[model samples]
Target: MLLIVGAGFAGLSAALRARHLGVAVTVVAGRERAFDAPECLSLEGVRALHDCGLDARQLQLPPVREYISRWGESPMLSRAPPPGIPKNIMLGRVQLLRALRACATEEGVTFVEADELYRVLPTRQGLQLQFTGPVQELVLDASFAIDASGRAAVLARKLGVGRRTFDHLVAYGVRGPVHGLPEGVVHTFSVADGWVFAVSDSPGQAHVCFYTNGRLAGRVTEAKIMERVPYQIRSLMSDEDMWLASGVSAANASTSLLDVPGGTYWLACGDALQTVDPLSSSGITTALQQGAAAVSAAVASLSGNLEPMRAYWLESRAHFDSYVRNRNSFYGFGESAS
Candidate 1:
């Protein structure tokens, strides 16, 4: 049996794929709601979802065909979708998680919802997990474990694997009713201090965020962000529309893979392994891909062939390195232009 931690896209994908491989899989996730913000589903992400048996069209997500950007007082620049590129969709993050979880359930994947992971002990036969929640205590033993607990890297950190953060960027945002915005286009404005992005996920509801260095982010208020945005966006903010702001690292970070794919017993995927800047717009796609790859690695390792796990580690490392390089280039361009 395989134990997957966290029930987000990564963990659910891993659970579903492992079940398809005829393996017994159980997913343990915290009780926290997944609806933190809005997310954009790129063409690649949409394909991944479809491969996982999700129909994006059936979800009724808004399709984005273009993007409008304004950089530091420059005139608005309109970008058309590139040929052969599939339409990208924007939807509420929580809604997608719920859909994925429902699909996993339909696939016969067991889900254990807990408030916290109390302990993980590796024993002679396999690994044992102890979880605490509102109802009662539960323990699970499995031959292998997949750490899809995201940036927390629960198992990785406990195993003494280290992580590296490449930048000190932070993003703060709010979600509320926003008017006077195009339905299917993302609007971005580059300010002197940082950048702001706004997109309407539904008819009237939207998500807006400001990405800035940590120091400035600490002092960035909603009013300040409103001032930085274009007049059209600023004018649409209604006093009755609620706003809330929270900050998280927008930097590139990755865990050192020294002990990952270790001895065919444990591995990490998704944000647990590496995280890219939001500008790359690859988080969900990368997470789903890694989740599927983790299942393949787990299946191969259980069969006494460790080659696939090793290869997966190398591939994950290479992907992170390439992502970092591209992220740096993109940020550098914005800085130079400013």
Candidate 2:
């Protein structure tokens, strides 16, 4: 049996693939914390979803048309399709999770909703996990474990995996009704020491956020950040007629990677393995694909072939290195924000 943790896109994709391969898989989900922001996916990412047996078309909504960014003194840059998005393709959290869970359930994947994981005991047969939900405590066994626990890397950390974080990037912002903006435009603006992003996830419901150093997050307020927003974005809420949800929130948007993707009978995928800047637009894209990657390595490891696990580590390292280079290159137009 295979045991998986977390229920985000990464976890669900892993479960969907594993069961399709006729593996007995059980998923332990502590919680699903959806980020209140817009998630972008490239064409390749859409293909990955279809590979995972999900109806990718259901999520294609709100329709993003172009990407606009104003950084340093460079002329405002605009990109279409590839960066703009090909068609009706904006991935929302609700639609994604609902579709993934439905697919997993129909395929005979067991789901255990738990409050927290208490113990991971190893036996000759497999790894035994003990967790508690609201009503009762439960235990399950599996030959291998796959961690999709997001940035926490819960299972990976417990198994002695170390993480190398590249920066102290954090994002603080709010989401609500934003009006009088070019419909379906994703905007990014470089401010005093950070950047601001604004986009309509659905109709008039806009998701906006400010990204900067963790230290500056606490010192800045929504009004102050809004003040730094470029005229184009500020125009969205600049009018007295415009209103929005108050109280900005914070979440880690740092770039980090795991020292080892996996060892022995366990491995990690998605945010648990590595994280990149949200602006890179690859986090969710890579996450949607990590499920299959994790399954391939885990299945090989379960069969006593450690080569796949080693290869997985090497691939993860290479991917992270390449991502950093690409991210840095993309930011070349802008001065350091933090």
Candidate 3:
């Protein structure tokens, strides 16, 4: 049996892969719904899946167009329009969650709803996962465990995995309809503090976020984050915009860093393993890919093929670590003094 914690993209992918290998897989999703950072599932994301032979049609996701941005400039520019791409289709986090859930159900994998995992203990027999709420304190026996619980590092912390802070990056974001907004453009700008982005073709909303420096963390609180959203666009949003009601200004509240520590029965994926600056806009893509990769490793281990775990670790680190180093260098940020 294979046990997976957190049924986000990585967890969902792992569960599917394990079932394909004839391994019994059970997933405990933290929330009933998957929460994708708004606009993280743009056309570029769908295109990646389509290009990999996973039919975006199968998941019923919308088409993502070009990207746009505005800083010192006026209107933003659209990306080079690509052919054969799906038109203006974008799936909300909820829809994506639904699709993955349906896939798992159809494949006969067990999914427990509203399941929040507090800790994972390694016993003589597989892993013992403790849950909060209505779920029982069940101990699952499996050859390996995949931790896809996002940045919380639930398993990483329990297993003593060490994390490293790369650079200081902060972002405040909200979602809403952008009146007269240009479609197909992901606009980015470098500010004195950090940067901001405006992306279109979102799930009925345009997403905007400002990334700032850690030095001003105190001023970037939830009550102040919205102040960072430009006034020229504030009127275009409605009162019901996501994250708008949460607070006026919200600090990014994330430690800008990467975690590369290894464990005997645990592996990390997505932001749980490493968090790069949002400038890359590849967080969701990398998460989906890492989830799939982690599943591959677990399946291999179950089939008496243990080498896949090593390969999975090395490959995942190479991509994320390279991105971190390159971003720091491009922005003239100094390497960690450590």
- For every model shown, the clashing-pair count is 0, 0, 21
Q: Write the per-residue lDDT of candidate 2 for residues 113-172, one digit (tens) a residue.
A: 887777877788777778787798878787999989889888877767799887788887
Q: What's the true lDDT of residue 166 in model 1?
A: 57
lDDT of 3 by residue, 1-338 (tens): 57777777667766776776677888867754443444445466666454333566776443445544344421211222223323334455666666776777888999765455666677775677767656565445656778787777677777767677654556666666665556545556544455666666544466766666666755556445555544644544555344466544343434333455346666777777776665555666677778777877767665678798889878876886677565545454447321
**Number of backbone clashes in candidate 1:** 0
* Candidate lDDT values, in order: 0.72, 0.74, 0.62
Determine the C-alpha RMSD for candidate 2 after optimal superposition of all C-alphas.
3.6
Model 1: residues >4 Å from true position, as ranges? Answer: 73-87, 219-264, 333-338
Per-residue lDDT, model 1, residue 102, is 91
How well does candidate 2 match the true structure in TM-score terms?
Answer: 0.87
Model 3 weakest lDDT span, ten residues long: 73-82
